[model samples]
Target: MHPLAKYAIGFVVLCFLLFLLAPFAIVPSGMRGVVTTFGKVDPVPLGEGIHLIMPLANRVVRIDVRVQKAETEGDAASRDLQQVVTKIALNYHLDPAHVSTVYQRIGEDVENRLIDPAVSEVFKSVTARYTAEELITKREEVREQISRALVARLTPYGILVDQFSITNFRFSAAFNQAIEAKVTAEQNKLKAERDLQRIQVEAEQKIASAKAEAESLRLQKQEVTAELLKLRAVENQRLAIEKWDGRLPTVSGGATPLISINPQQ
Candidate 1:
């Protein structure tokens, strides 16, 4: 054979082998590839790494199996008919074992078709069961109800719910104003009660002080008898004599001295 012909034949064989062994899909970590043959999906899924298949007849679509987030806000009415705007966040992913089923039905746009609608439906249903005030006070209960409902609704479709959260709840301005006024009124009422108690305590203290003073005066009055007065006068006279100097007082304007003294014996 000619050298050129030999080289051409070797090249053809190499090309054929390369095409035969070409990997059609490279499923990455945290992903699963769903295989489709001639537009029909196969229930079995392809795992991570390279996969070989018939060229041009088979295709692979990768579905993420990692935890993903979805957030949406919507308006709903509570049991009391008050309008409530709710924002929620959901964490979920395709069941790794059932990625093929999920892709076949829901496709890659899980957030739009599955998550958002499910959240809206469950949120509205749960919100309808509680009043606007309950929705605020029982937020954790509402969250759990939504989360459980989501899991029940989605698990059958091969979607898994990891976590759920209610981000915000907005009410009408009038309702907000009402709530604020109510809180202020309660605070004012408490302050008024405290002031009343303090006033009562102060009045009680004044009454007790008056009673004590009256009791002391009555005791003093009872102790001061006529005999006691006479004894006190005599005691005062004796004390004055002991304190007197060894001299008699002179008359003032020919009047008698205030303390009469015949002589200091």
Candidate 2:
């Protein structure tokens, strides 16, 4: 080979090696790298884009320094001594400023080593303060307490606890059946009570109406005296005589007529 051609080939090979080594020098966006020179960690963190480091003596540990989520599922004990399976999901992120401390103390397995324990502890502690009934009814309060505790415990470990949710809880099958039965019985009782109230209300209305009618009759009796009674009887007799549909009765001796007519008519 020609000397110039050999030199050119060597240059190309060097460029190819540099290209392969460039990944150690550069990091993707929204990422931070820790420089570990011969397994010795540097306190200063590496920023995004190209960086200069020892090709063979140094390496970079890339970490996603952004918000992330860690969800966990487990069983917890309720205040009522009930074993309930629960799902706890947490929104968390690594603190870019404390990446070194995080890596050093909790390491890359922070979710399992640190966050998991903290989540379990918080859930157990908070749930212990509430009964099974309250766990269902006042769930928001319990969740808030757990969230606060988790935040306080995880913040020191460079894990910012953003939000947490208690997704599901399963109670004993017997307890669930009992609850349903109790609710059904309550509904039936309410319906019966409402019906009884309606009947009583109707009875009261009828009694009032009867009393009103009795009072009216008493007033009519008072208005009708002996003279009014005689006049009413005479008027009824006149109508009956006028409505007679039979032959006239013959007078024997001097019998007075039942109805007298005016001579002018």
lDDT of 1 by residue, 1-265 (tens): 9999999999999899877756467999999989999989989999999988777788899889999999989689999999999789989988999988998898889899888998898889989999989999999998899999999999999999999999889999999998999999999999999999999999999999999999999999999999999999999999999999967788667976475657864
Q: All candidates' TM-scores?
A: 0.86, 0.83
Model 2 root-mean-square deviation: 3.4
- Tens-place lDDT per residue, model 2, 163-194, is 78989777889878877998899999999999
RMSD vs true structure, all candidates = 3.2, 3.4
Residue range with the least summed lDDT across 10 consecutive positions in model 2? 18-27
Best candidate, lDDT-wise?
1
lDDT of 2 at 265: 82
What are the lDDT figures for the candidates, one per model?
A: 0.91, 0.84
